[model samples]
Target: MSHGVNNVRSRWTLPDYKPTQKYENAYRVTARFLLWVEKTKNRKVVDKLDAALRDGTYQPEMWVKLTGLTVDQLWKEYGDDPALALTYK
Candidate 1:
């Protein structure tokens, strides 16, 4: 077999038991939101949001409105806590 085809299996292999993909999507979404916040507004909001995130009380909808994204989009993009997401509606 050619090396390219043979190595495909190796490339597809994930860590033996580690959930490396866990939170990756959330990180990506949060990173995007943070960058947007930093670019469009002062650091104060970012700092406040960061604090709220830690508190697990920040409704992602606020960011959704600021970013013009939909609740479903945020849901899929961030996988935010369902209870918090409910407040968005």
Candidate 2:
């Protein structure tokens, strides 16, 4: 979050540049989720699904059904890549 805020602050310091509240919020959310995914060693599909849930704009239960990962296991074994995780499926 600090990284994201610093990034926006740096940009704002530029002359004639103004950052919108909406843009900052969106980027902050994205950066935080990306940090979570990367540190968890999770892949794009799961990360996208997680982001969708965190944004609260969609119900991830349907995605869980399709992807075959319960919310608990999703967060637990996120260290594994999708293909490796799928092998145990």
By lDDT, the best candidate is: 1
lDDT by residue (1-89, candidate 2, tens digit) is: 13323545455321211222221345543343334444444446556766778888667474465456544554344333322111110
Error of 2 at 23 (Å): 22
Candidate 2 worst ten-residue window by lDDT: 80-89
> Model 1: per-residue lDDT, tens digit, 1-89?
12123335455311221223332446444444444344444346667667789999888675554555644554344334222111110
lDDT of each: 0.44, 0.42
Report the error of model 1 at residue 7, Å: 31
lDDT measured at residue 29 in model 1 versus the true structure, 0 to 100 = 43
lDDT of candidate 1? 0.44
After superposition, which runs of candidate 2 have C-alpha atoms over 4 Å from their true positions?
1-57, 79-89
